[model samples]
Target: MESLPEETSSSSSTTTSGGGVGCGGAGEKLPIRPPIQPPSEKYSPLDWSAYFDQESDVFIPESENVFHVYTAGKEGPVVFCLHGGGYSGLSFALAARKIKQEARIVAMDLRGHGKSSTENDLDLSIERLCGDVLAVIKTMHGDSPPAILLVGHSMGGAVAVHVAAKKVLPSLAGLIVVDVVEGTAMASLMHMQKLLSNRMQYFPSIEKAIEWSVKGGTLRNIDSARISIPSTVKYDDSKKCYVHRARLMETEQYWRGWYEGLSEKFLSSPVPKILLLAGTDRLDRALTIGQMQGKFQMVLVRHTGHAIQEDVPDEFAITVLNFISRNRIGPNGVEIPGLRRPMQSQQ
Candidate 1:
């Protein structure tokens, strides 16, 4: 298995027949015809049960909204995951399958996304999003919460930082923010609408949507896309096609709130934290200063897009497991055996 880099730095062959054939000449060699191949495996949607140990809705107390959650593994420190905008809990399906070997995963669908519902789903302001996460944790774990390692991606990363800053979850063990930086995210907000407008609004089937996601580079891993994309869309009886379950364009007003002040908050949180990014170029001013001060671990995962977890799940899992081991974190906040301490920085 490939290990993390020491520092935070960061093809098809065609075969052709050799013999040339003249027009029915006596010495002409016959052209070789390729034998029939088996039919291609359909890019069918995969069920949540295939990756997650259980799928259920946790009803928030004193509220009509119910959040859908996918849980994996029976034991170990809880790795609570929150998905990015326009994605669902299923986006972490592949990563959960691998990480569950060393830790439990609780990935939840945010309000207005996936199967999760709310009175005003579009109210995705930072405060409301944070409240949703806290509510779910309180309702599920009650007074006694397990040691949780919070992991979030993109918009979810912003939410994770805000949630951690609240310091409400006493058992919160650590934080992992993936491929999101406040400066970069805020700067990209202007172009988000154009990006959203350009996406295909409808698909003939879930398989087609998955295919498009892979081919269009929205998601590079086809297997991950097949399982995750299905949850991102819903069948439209009127249009006779599938449309995005969450209308991302409609939530444009909340985009800025998700990312503003994210870096400072992430650094201020009183917990061991790590920042995983697809490239070092995404680092903003605040993060660069924090990283220089050794405030948190910064990992650059090359060749991945924004969805680093789904793009390279094995690597992502190993990164998380290493984080847990390096921190000596175990189930229920105990020390795990046989885990090595992270190496010291030579520089």
Candidate 2:
């Protein structure tokens, strides 16, 4: 129900919250995702908007999903980043800039969220969601120097995992998945996404509405157990209501088949990788940091939730950087940590 921005060439497209074309039927063009580069001689502007330009697109030949890409560290390999729920590629601006300033980090807002436009096509399937990321890989075909590192948080983290499973990414040095617990089963997550969406629905007119969100905080019943995040709010005096900076459909689509067989997908990844998760969110921390199984390494961060990257950017960035710096199968493989039960394992 939101208006679509004017369409552009796959590489020229800008960011959007919903329907944007990608390599798949999603519409945006996609390029093969390259690897991270070394540091640059000088720093590029780290400020979100200033650092990013609507430059060359990474399009997928199959679908039209376009990820508005901004590059940094023209010197090193590439780091392909996927953002969390409702956040655009800009969410990584601060941390990406601070982390090894010269590294070329590419951040993208996946479909139905951030700057991607999901107007023409509706792909609520996890496979389709991953196709958007695939668009980036197909475009690069291997121009990178160092290696490609995939980092994703929450939904984006899921996308990173889906792609890492495929052997196509040989340059994939490592993977970093934030705040997600695998094997919980998709149906349970779908229900939770629905409950949260129902709670955050915006009113037709904020002026006539009893409550509205603000920059520092959101309007809500103090007693409500639900959690919230901080965001910049804009109130149009003419309209007499508050408009959230995030896209509406993004809020609604969180559970729309986000995990269509995701468990199976993780088990199917081509290589074992690293996982970073939150200790707070019951869902994220449900499983203990398991033993590293030569294929997978897991780390735990306390005091965070589903959106750990935004809640604590510096720590999140460091965790991911650390993983990429050490992308390898240890002699002992991965040492799975002890579990904090009622948590389950992949048996």
> lDDT values of the candidates?
0.85, 0.51
Residue 2 lDDT (model 1):
28
Model 2, 1-347: lDDT tens digits are 12223323343444434545434446655554443332221111123544433335565555556655655555454677787655556556555655545356777756655445544334545667676676666575433223667788767777787776654554565577776655543535546656546654443442322223222122222111011211222355666654544444444453545545554555445544566766533332223333333346667776544555555667866776666456542211232232111223368
Regions of model 1 farther than 4 Å from truth: 1-40, 334-347
Compared with the true structure, model 1 gives a TM-score of 0.85
Cα-based lDDT at residue 281, candidate 1: 94
Deviation in Å, model 1, residue 297 alpha carbon = 0.4
Per-model root-mean-square deviation over C-alphas: 9.1, 19.1
